[model samples]
Target chain A: MSPRRGTRRLRLSDPHRRVRFGLAVVLTVLTIIGGRLVQLQGLDGMKYAAAAEELRLTRLDLPAARGQILDRDGNALAYSVEARAIFADPGMIVAPGRTALALAPLLATSADALMGELTADGRFVYLARGLDPAGAQAIMDLQLAGIGELVEQRREYPAEWTAAQVVGFVGQDDTGLAGIEDQYDDVLTGTPGQLVYEQGRFGLPIPAATHSLEEAVPGSDVQLTLDQDLQFTLEQALAVANENAGVSSAQAVVLDVATGQVLAMGGSPGYNAADPGGVRGDQLANPTVSHVIEPGSVNKMITFAGALEEGLITPETELTVPDNIAVSDIVINDAWGHAPIHFTATGILGKSSNVGTVMLAQQLGNARLEEYLRRFGLGTATGIELPAESNGILLPHEEWSGSQAGTIPFGQGVSMTVLQMASMFQAVANDGVLVPPRIVDQVIGPDGTVIDQPGSEPRRVLEPDTSADLRYMLESVTNEGGTAPLARIDGYRVAGKTGTAQRPNPECRCYAGGGYWATFAGFAPADDPRYVIAISVEQPGGSGGGGVIAAPVFTSIMSFALGDNGVAPTGTPSPEFRLTTDED
Target chain B: MSALPAYDRPQRVAGRRTEPTRVSLQRPVAAPAPAGRAPFVALILFVIGAGLIALLVLNTAIAADSFTERSLSQQIEQLRLQEQELQQEIGAAQAPAALARAAVEQGMVPAGPPGFLIVHPDGTTQVVGEAKPATRPPPPARRN
Candidate 1:
């Protein structure tokens, strides 16, 4: 081989330089890739990490239930039950028409309406709310796309009409509308919860993925002082009285004399708490605390009580009471025509003589009379847990007209609720100590902690001896010759007063040619009173009087209450009462 | 030259010899044996590969169990819903109206005025009011 040929071969076979060039190119590309990797993994890592987490994580809201209303005996008056609400993902629905047709029968809706809901331009829409589990399951069994059921709580009232007025009702959104339900809505509503979890495809929670949950807190329950059985009895009695007397409406209330705890309170024409939309607005008002009427002869008790308390007269104080007496410009007369005769104070009250009452009220002037009425809790709301209580009409003594004093003395010008009337009697029956009425007994928390409700403090209205004297005088009213003879119980000594007030004509605002309000207020076992009952009938047809129409209602309710409470009759005979004086 | 010097001259043969052979008297060196570490390294690599394969299989089993747990959780939710439904039914059955209806169907009537049996402090009893019968005789005890 020649030296020139060998040199040419050496030039071609020198491979180290080519290898060095290829390695340089590879290192450059790898350096660029490593730099990019460092930037992505270190500099903006948190941003990318958040983005990735968002893709796999989901959040959900959990709803809590409203509390329940229970009677004193733990019977459920109003409660919440688990229910299902059906919703649709309109965006995910494939065939709106077909889905609507499949769901219409189960949802109890028109197919066209359902289609309209399903075709709306939204991600979610409510097809139906508060469906029974069975109904919801029937729809779920179809397995239609975009259809789902959400667990919800529905308010239910088990005792439909027993204490409907007091329990009130809830709106479609579970918000209380009236009565105790509205008063304690906040305490009755519970706290909601939240859920944070990882979601897989189809939005289902991924197994073994990150998950967290916050449990819901349930609401507290309220227990009222009312007895369901007694409430039912009172409602039934009022209903019967309303029907038998042909009255437009009637109301009754019973109270424990010692504690002032209302046992039963109801009014006729009550609305069902389950369905309250059909009831009239006026009827929705609880007549026992919301409606007011002139108390008529019942006001005589206050006048007599005041007189006895002030030492104005004794039980045997003789008075020459005429059949008619003039006060200011108004002439007050007895209900029946009678001659002027002399009688004792007990006889005057037992007969419920308006003339005699006016004479005694004159001795205790308007100032003292008004003061006594105020003390009896008239002209003010009862402050019950129920909503929309009325403060009855009582003008100041300075606002009285010439005849107002005369009419006010006999319960003609003043008006008060039935609860106030019962309260007045409760004061007398409890020996002149007036206790504010209580309707709620306790509140039970979700954790089973009991919170006792504070009862109202007792206020002294009259002396004990004066109350005793008044009780003795009032007992004569239910005797044989008294006005409320029908109010007598067979084995118990009854004390009560009868009232007949002519309702003011709506057009003329006068007491002429208008309907009448008949009322009876009393207690049982006059010596040892346990319960105070008051009944009132409005606008009774024909010639019905309080002694005839309202007295029997009082008797039936009082008897039942006494018997149910295990109160034994005194079994002692009542003292004799004098109907007439020696000069008669 | 003098008849090609017969002893020193090369002989003609069928195949050609490229080089002349030489012989040495010293001991022959042995050819290099394969490295001893190579087989050991190969065996370790095989075992590591098998362990990795087993790990992958176990992970797959765990993933399958996760699916079963999800299915069981779904079943538990369904059972809870069924229990709520049953509770609602029981509540409805015990409602006042339903109970009243059932009572009427069972030949029961509403109670009359209640009477009390008063127990005195001395433990003696006295009946206050008339005690009314609760239910009428069962059709005069139908003759067998």
Candidate 2:
């Protein structure tokens, strides 16, 4: 080889030139890449990321569980449970008719309705709102495309119609529409939440991906003071009472005298809380608090209370009472005809003498009677934890006409709720102290914290001696000679009053062709006076009175109340009552 | 043994016999070698390969766990539904109306007035109320 020639010949491909070329190419590529990075990371980043998330992310709205309504004994009166609802994505459905046919039987709905829903021009349609777990599983096993089930809730009323009026019902959207459910809607309903996560290709959440949960807070439970079993008994008895063709509706309530807790309250024509849609809208309300009636002889107690409080007469004071009396332009008469008789104040109340009561009222005057009426928690809502309570009609003392003065004393012109009538006797039964009745005993939080309701403040309505005297007087009504012998419980002594008042006709706006409200208010073991019960029946086309219609029911309930609570009679012998100074 | 016969046969075929190659040693003889970098290179390759396999296994485990978690969640949802159904059944069976209806079906009648037995402090028992002999009631009203 020629080494001199090789050295002299120019090296055409020099290392320096190759190095420069490589550097230039690398610099140009790096510049391009850097420019692309800036464009991607700075300017269009937000819009791109949002688009990607929109494709890969899914958000779900989680509804919190509604609280339960429990009775005093920790029994569930109403509860909400998660159920499944059948929905269809019409756009994804291949054959609407076939899918509907397969789903109709499981969903318990018409095939035609489902077909219409499945073919509707929307992305989603509900074929059934609630399906049990087994039924939902059956539908899912069919694996029909476009048909899917989602979690929903169904409110179950296990007690059925027992305390339906007091416990109330919920609407389709889980909103409380009536009763305690409606009154404590905020307490029973909870806050909603959201769950957001990145979705994988198979509709499952990606592992360790971005996930967030805004948790839902469940509602607190509200426990009522009602006794479930006693409520059932009252409901059963009231239902039987309403079976008469003449009777339109009936109502009843029982209370604990000391605590003023409503142990049981019910009415006829009650709706099932689980299925409120089957009944008339007007019938869904609790008539005991919402409806009013001329309280009749049930109102005489207040008049007598006022007289005794004002030192007008003692139980043994004798008075000459006639069959009828003319006060202002109206002539009021007793239910039975009688000549002038000398009788004690106890006999006047025990016999439910309208004329005698008015005579005492005349002595007491209107202001004092109205004042007594107000003190009995009348002419106003009872401030109970119920919705749509009525403040019954009681004319202010200044607004009383002449005839009103006569009849108002005997509860003819005056109208009050059944609850008010019951409360009147409660004051006497509780030794002259008045405690406003309450239905809710306490509230239980979701996390197991207990919130007790403040005890109701009781006020004095009558002196203790006057209350004792009243109890002695009222007990005569359930005896042999007085009215309402059927109200006599077997073992315990019962004290009660009976009222039969004519109702005003709605069409005529008068008393011509109206009905009569037969009412009974009483308490058992009259000496101790533990439980107070009141019942009423409205007979629109009948001639029966409270003794005939209302007293028997009271007997059934009062006997049970005494026996169920295991209350013992005082065993004190009954003292002889001087009903008449001239003994018959 | 068959291969030796073939080799003899080729040799006997004389005209196509292969020539024996001559072997010679080089002038610059190789040094007695110490251990070379080949083993180290092999070790590095093995470590890189092992690390890559471990990464693959970890990723597979995570993906599998994600799938298991999804199935478990679905199972949990089904169990929740089952619990709800059971609760509903219990509530229905224990409801007062249902009990009354059941009692009627079993030839049981609603009780009348209840009586009490008074126990005196001296260990004497006396019936307080009249315990009326039970009579058959009128057929129960058709209740729901």
Candidate 3:
């Protein structure tokens, strides 16, 4: 047989092998296709879908306004107003030097300064921070290419320095920096809104087809316990005190006796919270709470209150006061040299007798006396919710020396914040209860609902009958021959105390030469106390004390506050007192 | 058990092969009546399965979209609140009352009755609070 014929016959005979080869190829192709289908449908499908959705959608946030600060009468003490500021897109400016030159005159800036700002590498640069409408408009009218006003917000102060320190100010970025602005920042800042839009292929939003949009939630408004008219009156009185006494610093605080609410707080030479550049160094400190000094004769009021509270003395109690008395190896003297003068308990307070005060303190003893001072809210911070309140110095009873013993009775050894004085005086005026001072009247939410309401919560500091008796004795402080005669109001029964404490010499451990702090604390309409005012003047020209400086200021503030609050005059004459020979 | 053959007739084995002794293993004489019941059951099953799958896919898509939208809305609201607060602060910082207060603090008292003069177009000026107006002559011009 031929070789070619034999091979052809062999090939034709293996038909089963050919069919198996064809079936194997078909199976391989099907496996590859199935694997790819699984990868697309099961393994990576969600990841791809999310990427596609992200490429088509974009969201942006919008911000809300800060809260408003208003007075009790709903007058805007501090509120927001819109203003324009010119900002430059540095990338867009064609000629930085030329643009700076054109803007310098319009912005009231030097050309060099403008050039420095223009040459900054930032995309957005502030050419001017606070520009008026006319100035902004003028700059815009110049048609300077690349320089334009950015629609950014600026804070506006409607009342400026009227309630400067209380309202506080915001920084250039509109963040609160001090005062109440710093304090309720969270409540004052509102919720931002969202704008969702469809995005194009290159990740830019499609102009017209923005989908879902949400509005911003605005901030709540804050209402204060202060009255604008009463605040103005208090400021005027402080100004008068500063002028008359030539004092470097002075402060006055007025509060409602029944409710611990602060009505007016004023300091001389205050700054505009909106424009902080005009602040002075010495005047920056709030003297009413930040500075501490010896209280002098004002301490006698505390001593008298303690004695009366303990039933140690009454209006008819007779005490024979000499010019000087030696106790605990320390000599105490009256303000005027005189013979053994017979004086009632009422007379002793009226004359502000140093010997009389010591006799009372000695009768009460150390433990009882210290307890009363503590109860009266002395030598400690009043916790009035304002920052930087000084805790005045009070030596522990274990550390009290013989000299401090006699001196403390007439307000020499201890010191207290003006708020503490006002609070303690409120106890006498309020018939026995001492309420914590409140500066915030109410917190209103964005929807005009009151979120937090403040009211007086009184704690009994003295017995009711004792408070009345003390009020009767305090009446003498505003009458003729009293140390605080200037504190009298024509138609009201005012109760007050005067102080002239010598500046303590830390080096010598004794009072220094000619430096004194004058102070007066009082309340009006003794029958039904309405207002309590305390004023302090540092280093007046004369031997400054409550009588010569602080008393007059207190009188003015009290009179104005009473009138503003619609408190009618009592028209009752000052209680008269006569020395009695009989001892109680 | 080889065939006993047709020799043993049906009358002898009546109990065992009652109807037909050997049924032919060939095509049936005629096709039995065609049944329509199976097709109806298959149709009902397909419809129910398709509806359930469609419902699951729709629910998943809606849930994903709603979750994304809610988060985006919350973020936008937060930003809007921040912007409003900033705007209010800016306004308060530049209030008219603040400007007036600043002026007063700088010792620039307001011009009022008894001191400053108000000039009118008739070449006449009046003192504050005064009833009569005074006439003034024009000043000599200055050369640049």
Model 1 / residue A572 / CA error / Å: 2.0
Give me the candidate number with maximum TM-score. Answer: 2
Better of 1 and 3 by DockQ: 1
lDDT by residue for model 1 over B65-94, one digit each (tens)?
Answer: 777878998899788778867766676676
DockQ of each: 0.13, 0.38, 0.07
Per-model chain B TM-scores are 0.54, 0.57, 0.40
B52-109 in candidate 3: lDDT tens per residue? 8998888667656666666797678556656755765555545444443555566554
Model 3 agreement with the true structure over A1-584: per-residue lDDT tens digits: 68988987887578886678677888888888888888877898888877777668787765576788887877767655445679888888899888888888888889999888787897888788666555687899988777887544456665566667677778877777666676767777778787788876554445445478898787888888888767766766666666664476677788888788888886776776657767765554456677777778888888898899899999879898888999788788888898887889988998889998898999998788888888877777776656677888888877899888888888887988777778889888988888877787888898889987546566787999989988888878777667787887756788888888787555677665546778898898878899998877777345666897899898767866765555665545666755434333
Top lDDT hit: 2
TM-score of chain B of 3: 0.40
DockQ of 3: 0.07
Residue A550's lDDT in candidate 2: 95
Score every model by TM-score. 0.82, 0.88, 0.71
Ranked by lDDT, the better of candidates 2 and 3 is 2
Residue A80 CA displacement from its true place in model 2, Å:
1.0
TM-score of chain A of 2: 0.92
Clashing pairs in 2: none
State the lDDT of candidate 2 residue by residue for B1-144, as single tens digits: 232344333332433233323112222333332377457656777888899999999988998998898799989988887787788889988887888778878878766555668888999997766666657573465464
| Candidate 3 residue spans exceeding 4 A from truth | A1-61, A83-85, A89-92, A122-124, A130-152, A198-210, A454-456, A505-510, A579-584, B1-144
DockQ of 2: 0.38
